[model samples]
Target: MENMLVTRFGHAAVLVETEDARVLLDPGVFSVDEVFELERLDAIVVTHQHPDHLDRSRADALLARNRGALLLADPQTVEQLGAPWRAHRDGDRATFGSTTIAAVGELHAEIAPQLPRVSNVGVLVRSETGPTIFHPGDSYATVPADVDVLALPLSAPWAKVSETIAFAQQVAPAIAFPIHDRTISDAAYDIYWNHVANFGGVADLRRLGQTEATQV
Candidate 1:
């Protein structure tokens, strides 16, 4: 894959552009303003209904701008979002332009036994001209094989360093990068980064700066 680009917009939001298509993932509240400014998107995928991942307040406007883009979300989120949003469940597949998206995983990681679980579907994206990438939204419940790049969630209420490292080992991608990292402070970022670099079992771990586009 040549000229493939992945641009992070803080936390879990990212823009993936290949030679044939452009896709946006998890445009949550923490995502930067530039996300809304984007046009000509092939698809806008939401992992779940969480405000941090869906950004209900601004979603309508974003969709209005990219009227041609497919709005896909988890089953429960589809019910909540209604028209214009379709369900993307485990084993389901969809195509936008030359990019193919396959849904995997089912539920969000257990935050606690008391809190109810919600649907969360991770997506695997493949393009004829780009590397295969996987983004496991809020869960490590399912591990897909033959991934070229992994969007590893670096921090969250339900995530731990051990599980994060183990998840990376299980997927065993050629390269990995951090996401879901709004909670990390400047002082503590290196601690997490170093641990993953030393033990995550991936050959390369690239830390993306906010809004910076990097080739993976």
Candidate 2:
């Protein structure tokens, strides 16, 4: 078993690479540029149909480039995007070469009471040798199990500082880092970090910026 490489493309998109597989998760608007640079992928997983998580044109472009890559997403998203893709619910699991991806959770956190809630699936990717990595999409849904590397969200319309910190502590991953933070200002980021660092007791919280990677 070889180590898996986790690379962030800012916002919700991430590239999880193992010796034999390369998986791209949520290649949305914020990550389209980074996604465009990739030459090949084994799979592309989308959490939902939100523009921020699934940019239609860019995703199509990616699939066009790599004809063999598979597209995996929740049922709602699959309905919206349509065909040639796998629909994963809360408990579905799929394997591609050396990597296994499990879909967790079903609904996106509420942006507001009046706004329609969309489907969102937090992805848990594991391999034989590397640390398990969980990207919880846009929801602070329960972590199905302990992970080695948790991609925690720092800021979003549906999240707050306290809730995000609590989520991290609850998941209790061996190492936690931030994602879904493209909307905040520099000052807001400082505030989020302050609270998260102070209240995220016992969890090894690492501040990972856009396009950053943490050794697994």
RMSD each, Å: 1.1, 1.7
Please name the candidate that would achieve the greatest lDDT relative to the true structure.
Answer: 1
Writing each residue's lDDT as its tens digit, candidate 2 over 19-72 gives 778888888888738775676888889988888788887776688887888789
lDDT of all the models against the reference?
A: 0.89, 0.82
Off by over 4 Å in 1: none
Kindly report which residue pairs in candidate 1 clash with one another. Answer: none
Worst 10-residue lDDT window, candidate 1? 1-10
After superposition, the stretches of candidate 2 with alpha carbons farther than 4 Å from their true spots are none
TM-score per model over all chains: 0.97, 0.93
Tens digits of lDDT, candidate 1, 1-216: 555789998889988887767889999998888888889998899998887787888877889889999888999999987988999999999876677889999999999989999999998989866789999999987999889999999988998999999999999999899999888998999999899999999887888877877887
